[model samples]
Target: MQNEKRDQLVVSKKTYKKSNELINAMGKGTALSQKLFAIGMQNIKVDETNNVVATIYGTELRKMFKSSSGSLYEHIEALCDRQIKGATIFDWNLLMKDKENGKIEAHQVVTDASFKNGTLTLRYNNSLTDKIVNLQKDYTVLSLADTLSLKSVYSLRLYEMLKSAYDYQRAVTKMQGEMVFEYKLTELKLELGIINSGGSKEIKTELEKEFPDYDRIDELAEKTGQTKYKEYKIFNRNVLSKAKEELNKKTSLQVDYEPIKNGRKTEGIRFFVTKKDAEAVEKTAEVAVNKDEILDDLIDLMHDDFKLREIRELAELAEYDYDKIKKSYDYMNSYSSPVDVPIAFMKDCIKNEYYNNKTTKFRPKSSNSFNNFEQRNDYDFEELEKKLLDN
Candidate 1:
C-alpha cells in the first residue's frame, strides 16, 4: 500500500511535460486557468481554528481573479473545479516500521486539500512531519522543450552541436595535422549550411540521405584530424616521412660494445723488481746529489720552523759574504714561514759551488788578517767565526 502511494508521488517525464504544457497554456490567459494558477502561487497558512486561509490584499486578489462577487470560498471552489481542468488531488500517507523487532511503530496521513478561504493546503500528521517537510523543500516545477517555440529549441540544440564540432576541430589540428581534421571541417560545413539554408525537416532528410555517413565521419574526424581540413592529408604525410628519416638515421649510427666479464683478468705482461735493485737505485741517486744540492735540501727541510738559522747555515757552507747572506735571508723571511726556495737560488748555488771547486785560488774573506777583516766586516770576529763554523 505504501509502495503504491510512493509510486504515485514520483512524477515521470510525461507527467512533467503535461504540467509544463498546463503552465504555458495558462500563461496564454484562460480566465479559470489563470485563477487556478494564481491560487497555487499564493502562500497558505493555518489559523487558530485549524482552518487554512489564503491571504492577499483584497484589491490584489480581485485584480488577479477578475472577480468581486460571492464569498472568497465560493470563488476558490469554482476556480478549483473549473480552472484546474483535469487536475486531481491525492491523499498520501507515511508509515514507519521497525525492522529490528518487526513492529508497525508509527502511521500517519498526509493529504492535499483546498481550504475554505481558497488556500491550497497539504497537511501531515505530527508523526509524518519530517517526511512532509523534506518533500516540500525538494519540490520543483517541471520544464519541457515543447513549452517553448520549436524554432527556439532547435536553434539552441544546433548552436551546441556547432560549438562542439568547432572545439573538436581545434583539438585535432593541434595533435596530428589539418588533414586529420578534414572530417570535422566537413561536418561543420554541413551543419552551417543547414543552419543558413533554413533548418527545414525536408532539407534535413535530403542532406542525411546524401551524407549517409555524416555522424560516423564527424566523430572519427574529430578524433583524427589535426587542425584544418585543407592541410590534413599533406601535414600527416610530411610528419610521417620526417619521422621515418629520423628513425633511419638513428638506426644507422655506429656503436662499439665492450663485453663484460665476471672477474678481472690481466692480458698484458707484468714485471717485478727486487729489493736489491731498489737499494742500488737509491744509492746512485744519493751519489748524484752534490754538496750544493745537499745544502739546498737541508735548507728546505729546516726553513719552516727555523728560517734565519737555515739561511745562516746555507751562507756559511756556501762561503757567501755576510752582507749578501743577510740580504738573502731578509728577502726569504719577507715571504710566509713555510718558504719554497726559488729554483733560481738552487741553480746559482750549484754554479757558485762549481766555480769555487774549479778555481782553487778562491779564498774566504774572513781568512784575511783580523784588522783587514775588521775593516771590511761590520760584525765582530768571534761572532762571524762562530756562525761560519757552527754548521
Candidate 2:
C-alpha cells in the first residue's frame, strides 16, 4: 500500500496506515514486565523462513541508556527477556482478509519469541509474512528511518498511535482539513504496552531485576491500587507526558493532547500533531526540527549529563557542527586517562578549536601565573620528547 499512489490507496473503516517508526517506537517503559519494548522491528520482513531476528548492539544502545561497561549487556539481555518472556504476548496481531468476500480476518502476530546468544528470534506458526498475509485488510509499509532514531520507548509508542490515528483520520476526512486523532484511555494504555498487571508474578519479578532504578513502579503501584500502572493519572505521568517531551525534542512531529470525557469522567485522548517543518516551528532553521535533533544526538554521545546552558555553550563553541563535536567526543573517549569532567573537557576542546584548527589561548585575568611552551623556559623539553618516544 505504501508503494501505491496516495490518491489510489484504499482505506478500510476499521484499519489504518502507520509509519514503521511509530510502530517500532510504541514500546514504553511504563508497560507491564517490559511492555515498552523497542527492538528495531522496522527490519522485520516476514517470509517463508517463519522467523524474524531483531538485533541491537550494546554500543548503539548506549546512546539511549546511561550504562556502565559490561553492565549494558546484562541489561540488554534482561530487556529481551522482559519483551518476550514466559506467558507474555503468547501471540501477535495476525489478521488476514477473505479476498473473495472482501472481509478481514485475524491471526497471531508471532507464535513465540526466544532470546539467546544476544539475539532475539520471533517465530511464526504459519507463513504469514507482510507480503502474503491477508489480515482483514492489506498492510501499509511506511518509511522506517524516523522511528529508528527515537530513544524513548514511550515516545516511539505515542508516535505510532498518533501517526496511525492521524493517517486513519486523514483518510476519513479525504486528506483535507485540520486533523486530530482520538483514542480511548484503555486503548491508549494498551498501545503503550501497559497491560493489566497480575498475569504472572513470578515472571514479573524476574523481569524487574533488569531495570534497577524502576522502584517508582512499585511506589505508584501501591498508590494506584493495582498493577500494570496503578491508574490513568499515574500512567500519564510515567508514560504519556514523558513520551510527549521526548517526541517534541527528538522527532519531526510536534505533539499536543487534550482529555475527553464521558459525562465528566475522563475517558480518552484527543491529540494534535503537526509537522514541525511545515508549521514554521519556533527558531526555524532550514529544517526547523533538525536543529534540536542534531543537538540531541550530540548530547546523547556525551559521557555525562550536561545542563542545557552548557550544551548550548558547547554548540556555540563547536560552531554548531555535528561532525566536529562527534569526532572530538570519540577522540576524548579513546584516552587512557579518563578526563575528570567530560562536558567540561568537550567545551574546552571546542573552544580551543583542537581538531586541526588552532585558536588563541584564553585565560582568566584572575590567574596569577601563565606559561607559553615556546616563550617560557620550560623544563627539559628535549627530555620530555625523549621520554614520550621511549614510552
Candidate 3:
C-alpha cells in the first residue's frame, strides 16, 4: 500500500509538471499575449476587469491610487480609460474556457502603462494573451472559498486547543477539592519521606542527629522562649496534633469547612516543568503545548491560522483593495482563536463581515501619465456630513 501511494504521488508530480509545461508553452510569443487578452476580455464581460488588475498589482497599486483603494474594478476601468487609452478590453468567454481547463490561472493584472512595452499587460494569468482581458468571475468566488477553508481549519484547531486548556484547568481545580491542615501536613510528610527514603535515613532520628549542628533550629527555639530541646519538641507535637485532630474530625463528620484563615488563598498551583514534558501532554490534551525551546510557536500558529488565504485570493480576483484588505486583516486580528470567544464564533464573525460589506477602498488605477495622475477620493462627503450631523 505504501509503495502504491508513493507511486501515485510520483505520477501526480509528473502530471503537474506536464501541465505546467503545456501552460507555459501556451503563454509564449503572440500566442501568450493573445490568450491573456482573451481571458481579460472574459473578465471585462463579467465586469470583473478590476478584479484581474487587483490580482496582478495587489495592494501596491491600491496604495498608489488611494481614491479607489477598496474598489479594484473601478480602478481598472479608470486605468483603461486614462492609461491604456481604452485599447485593452476583456474577452470573458475565452478566459472562462481557459480557467475551466486549468490552462490559465488568474493571479493578478498589471495596469501600469509601462507594462509590456507601454501596452497594459495582464501580467500573471497563465492563459493566452487574447484571454488576458477576460476575467473569470466564478474563479474569484472559488478562490475566496478556498482561502476561507484553509483559514477555518487552522482557526478551529487552535480554538479547540485553547478550549481544552481552559477545561483542563477547571478539571484540575475540581480534583483538588480542599486543602486542610492535615492535608498540608500529609503533603509535607510525603515530601520529607521522599527526601529521607532517597538517603536511607530515618527522618526523626536524622533530624535529632542534625539538630545540634543547625544553629537556626537553636535560634528559632530561643526566639520562641523554649529553652530545652525536649520542651520545644513537646510544644511542636501538641500544636500539630491539635490541628490534625480538628481536620480529621471535620472530614469524618462530613462537615464542610474552609481551612484557610486570615490570608489570601490560591485557587490553583503553578509549577515549572521541562518543555519535553509539556509537549508530551499537549499532544494528547489539545492544548498549546510545546518544548520550551520553541516558545514562539503559539504566536506563529495563531497568526497563520487567522489570516485567511481566501481573502487575499478574493482581493486578487477583484483587483487588490488595500483598504478592504486592511479592514479585513484588522477584523481577523481582533478576534484571534486563542484570545477571542471561540473558533466557530471567530469564523462566523469574519465571514459575515467579509460577505456583507459592499464597498472596499483598496485598489487604485493609474492615470494616463504619471506626471498628470489625479488623486482618487475614497470618502463620500455627502454621506460623511449626514453621519456627522446625525451623531
Among the numbered candidates, top TM-score falls to 2
State in Å the error of residue 241, model 3.
27
Model 2 stretches astray by more than 4 angstroms:
1-49, 52-141, 197-233, 262-264, 274-391
lDDT (Cα, tens digit) per residue for candidate 2, span 91-116: 23422333465333344444555555
Q: Give the CA lDDT, 0 to 100, for residue 365 in model 1.
A: 31
Segments of candidate 1 deviating more than 4 angstroms: 1-61, 66-75, 78-391
Compose the digit string of candidate 1's lDDT tens values, residues 234-304.
Answer: 42344323323322222111112121222562111111111123344334323322322334444454344
- Give the Å error, residue 126, model 3: 68
Q: Write candidate 3's Cα lDDT for 278-368 as tens digits.
A: 3432242222111111212222333334322333233343334344444445554653243222233333434455434434312223334
TM-score of each: 0.17, 0.46, 0.14
Listed per candidate, the RMSD to the true structure in angstroms reads 46.2, 14.4, 30.4
Question: Relative to the unseen true structure, what is the C-alpha lDDT of residue 369 in candidate 2, on a scale of 0 to 100?
Answer: 32
Q: Rank the candidates by TM-score, best first.
A: 2, 1, 3
